[model samples]
Target: MRKYSRKKKEIAVEDYVSGIKSGDRTMLARAITLVESHTNRHFTVAQQVIEQLGSVKTNSIRIGITGVPGAGKSTFIDSFGTYLCELGYRVAVLAVDPSSEVSKGSILGDKTRMERLSNNPRAFIRPSPSSGTLGGVNRKTRETIFLCEAAGFDIILIETVGVGQGEFVVRSMVDFFLLLVLTGAGDELQTMKKGIMELPDLVVVNKADGDNVSKAKQAMREYNTILHFLRPYTEGWTTKAVTASALEETGLIEIYKEIEQFIHMTRNNGIFEKRRTEQLKEWFDSSLKDKLYAQFFYDEKMKESLLQYEKLIIDGEKTVGNSVNELISLFLNKKE
Candidate 1:
């Protein structure tokens, strides 16, 4: 694997662009890794290659699917993603997994869960490590989406573990955000948080095909009533509550139809374009922070000074406010 990756990296930027455009999954995976790399050399090469390929110039439907653990998220993706492929659409599943503490690498277990989608030629599945980012998504996810679009994937599904409040970043990045809920968890009114209720483009109750059907319907009804009282996530459209059963493949079509209707309505009203623009702006701002932090954090002098101030705080020799001011002064006084 290491030799193959090294060889893939040696492929020139033009070749990388060509391979990505040709929809070669190996090349696509390697390109995504290059973008996720933190080294200066890899970063420069990735940027150059991305500029040449012009992933941002292409267009695709970006969908974010977030649900709590045990909500059958992977099963839902397998069923829904297969449905998408049957309609002759090229689909990509970017599954973000929690980072393992020891190696800081993802468990990469979603493939086992999404077996059918993984095997489907019409589908491309990539499981990425969250790398301990606050949200369950890594920073390069936006760039990956761009690459997937350029690689001929018309539909991009971003699957994230439900990190509760941390899901906002995923919400901001996608065209449609789907929140999957399971039945019999609890009373929706008591368990659902207001912020989550307002964030999803659509709230779907999964496992609706089993004996849980009645409970699922009840949850849907309860959510619809609760959602009536809150402001809509999108300006023109109210978020819809529905149910699904990934095991039986029931309601997947209905879920997709709702997704299409939302996209159509948002595109016609200009919300879709506006949302994409805002996400790019966010990416720009966040990248600025990373650049600034890299510059400051890598300086040996700054590191020593920060440690000294940190020690003072630990020993109660200085207040955190004073230490912050000292660090700010140290940073500003240094020559650019």
Candidate 2:
């Protein structure tokens, strides 16, 4: 215990918070590492850091970027993040990579892919493993966002794994959700149309250079039409689709401008605050559900009973619904 105390003291949460407030990138990374740690021993320090972070108050513009596997999301974020840094905005990117279930660890290739951006002093890139969590956004991501904001990043970009369900989870956590699309016509557009079309605050047909420029433009038009039919997420904020060549850095500025316009419109109409309030409510509800589920499954007797119930179901002695009800009764009785 004394050795553990010494190591904890060596990290110094107050020093980390001070460095973060001054926009020190190293300190910011260290803070995130500490928060992401699985050890419960860090909880006290983590809470203290979170408390100090309250003063920072997250004025950052949170953006979620998602697309199918080949849609050039990493490249676009690398280019766009560089643009933001050049314009003097401190940026933090949280890229959620899918973890291999067997290994329970991420490939962590986003940093390698976005080499230049990863090296930027004004930018911090963290690649987090999805850990098979129900939501595309991991449990620790919300906390990490606050840490980034406290560290003075004015722009927070969350890049989700391109899987459709993950995209929706990412959308819920951001102020703006940008969907990257590739050049496609009838079949391809129809395939992507359902999962992503309704959620994106802005859609960009990426890889718009080379021979695909015309096709990309046509796809953008198709997406625009799709957007018209889906009800706008908030009144006075219209979703727009555009084309961009991340390789050539073309149309990136326009995307940023559109985001600014959307933010302005939403804030003026009070929808921005309302959305944030709703997001907080969702976070609270999700936390409650998670706690309840953990308690239900983690109780020693519940685990043993669940195994027994599974055996009974396999042997045809109990119906699945009745078994579940029995488990719930045991769970409730135990609580009582």
Candidate 3:
């Protein structure tokens, strides 16, 4: 009998870059998954692919949509993206779904609900599993944005997991942040809080059709009152409230106009490029911190030292602060 050995297939960086630049959706999807991977080789390949796509000039509209559960996020994206596609725009929707505890995967599966956009040749939708990442988004999402832009998509909509504090993370990466709110859903208190209200460039009262129309209008009024008290979330823009019915595809035009107005205002005032520059700087620092921490903590010798320090803390032999300092010193001094 012969023993069999299998080698992993090598990724060609130029091929991915060329394909993405040529607007090949398959290669774009592959590049996104490659960057999302945690392997060392894939990391190298991801870097190469991004580098080869340096300074892509596509001025795609990057927007982040966040809301509490049941705020009609998927339907909103489907309607908004379909509208954009009808206008001859190539749109990409990146929906971040909450992870399942058992499998650690996206539980809702955004595709099932985005049938209209999925069938549109002008649209591409990718659902990413948050996997309980601290920010409720994948760390590689910034990289994914670049890939989508390089693929010549004119519009990019990022739908966050909408589970606590994740809105802030998504806000940092997009030109406009839209907060979707439900009517008569006790969201007045949700919108009353200063932190959540400060994130949106626009606050939308979703499901504003039919019998809920009055409640949605009332919710819009309430949100407007709240916004009047809070300072503007972004420079050169005021957060406005509007009503929309994603299921009926009504009020989407207003949302689109708001986005266009934001982009125009920011671009004319030079804030658009400035914001993107700041986002890139923040991403670089965050990635550097992650890499350094991984290198220091994952070393075999350092891992053993960390376990020993953890035991000391568990046994109350050393304070957490003191143990952290000692562990840093151990790595700095290259001691096991």
Highest TM-score model number: 3
The predicted structure with the larger TM-score, 2 or 3, is 3
Error of 1 at 163 (Å): 2.0
* Tens digit of per-residue lDDT, candidate 3, span 180-203: 888753544554444787889999
Model 2, 117-147: lDDT tens per residue? 8888888888775354333134457778878
CA error at residue 106 for candidate 3, angstroms:
3.0
lDDT of residue 268 for candidate 2 = 87
Where does model 2 exceed 4 Å of error? Answer: 1-10, 97-108, 130-138, 287-336
The per-prediction tally of clashing pairs is 0, 0, 0
What are the Cα lDDT values of the candidates? Answer: 0.79, 0.77, 0.80
Q: Which 10-residue window in model 1 sums to the lowest lDDT?
A: 130-139
Q: Show pairs that collide, candidate 3.
A: none
By summed lDDT, which 10 consecutive residues of candidate 2 come out lowest? 130-139
Query: Given candidate 2, what's the lDDT at residue 282?
Result: 74
Report the CA-based lDDT of candidate 2 relative to the real structure.
0.77
* lDDT of model 1 at position 248: 92
- On lDDT, the candidate that comes out on top is 3
User: TM-score of the candidate numbered 1?
Assistant: 0.82
